[model samples]
Target: MALNAAVALGSMFFGLVALFRPQAMPGRPLTSPGSQMTQPSEATTYFARMYAARAVPFGIATAAVCILLPSQAAIWLLAAGAIELLDAMVVASRNPREAAPPLLAVVVHIGSAVWLMTA
Candidate 1:
């Protein structure tokens, strides 16, 4: 449980990083440091907004796993992390140029998930 909590906290931290530094993420539509889509297409803006929006939920879920379900948090975290990893791969494969940061995060998440699950 302690390990799970630690992993969850770590995930939460990264999620916050994503929230605050969307551009620092090195991902498409989110490539600039602290970048918010403001040019070319409104679709890019929409995508950035959506990505920012999703961060909150992910952050909450991760924090919940840490604080609310210590005993089973590892299981939940692992599942969520796996889903994120798969999504990251999909994103990367489809657009390698802009998926770098996300791919990195996904790998980190996977490692933490593995640790949480196997701890």
Candidate 2:
């Protein structure tokens, strides 16, 4: 229960960062201090913003359900896990090395789901 809310909040935070600073997103290299970061192409920025938009709403809804309807949170948890799994697959298709974080996210989501089910 708590895990779901925590993860939801974390997702929202990440989404917000990605929305405002897409270059700071995971797998997207960030320039070191003092070095100007190269801006991504229009298509890249567009897609990153799109992803951020999806994440924000999903996290908000998931967190809302977790707090307002705990009994229904498990389904959202599972859905989040599935989303991460698919994200991992997509990253793996492009670059296997970049898939680890999302794969770990998948594990966390599944673990949270299991904890919710057991508790």
Candidate 3:
């Protein structure tokens, strides 16, 4: 439960950063620091902001479920895990070299989901 809360808060923080300070996001090794998208086009910026917006709500919902509706936490955690796993796959497909972090995140989400289910 505590772990879930922490993860949720962390997600919210990153989501906020991604939303307001997309410039702070890490980029690929070949790209400039804090610039994930190869070319900083309007469409890319829009996508970044949109992703951030989605993450913010997801984080809030996850935290709310963990705190206010404990019984639903397991299902939510599992869903989050599945989402992260798919995200990892997408990241890997786009950039194999930079997939480690997302893969790690998928592991953490899945592990947390398992823990929640067992607890």
Q: Best candidate, TM-score-wise?
A: 2
* Residue-level lDDT tens digits of model 2 in 1-119: 66666776777777788778777666654454564676655555676688788888998887788789887677788898898788789768767898886687778778877877898
Candidate 2: segments with Cα more than 4 A from true spot: 29-36, 93-98, 114-119
Each candidate's TM vs. the true structure?
0.52, 0.74, 0.69
The residue pairs that clash in candidate 3, if any, are none
Q: What would the per-residue lDDT of candidate 1 be over residues 25-98, giving only the tens digit for each residue?
A: 43454333453553324444455456556655675676676677665665666665675666567567757765
Instruction: Give the Cα error of residue 99 in candidate 3, in Å.
Output: 4.3
Q: What is the C-alpha local distance difference test score of candidate 3?
A: 0.66
lDDT of all predictions, in order shown?
0.56, 0.75, 0.66
Q: How close is candidate 2 to the true structure, as a TM-score?
A: 0.74
Write candidate 3's Cα lDDT for 24-65 as tens digits: 554421334465545454554565587678678887888788
* Candidate 1 off by > 4 Å: 1-25, 28-40, 94-119
TM-score of 1: 0.52
Clashes of 2: 0
Of 1 and 2, the candidate ahead on TM-score is 2
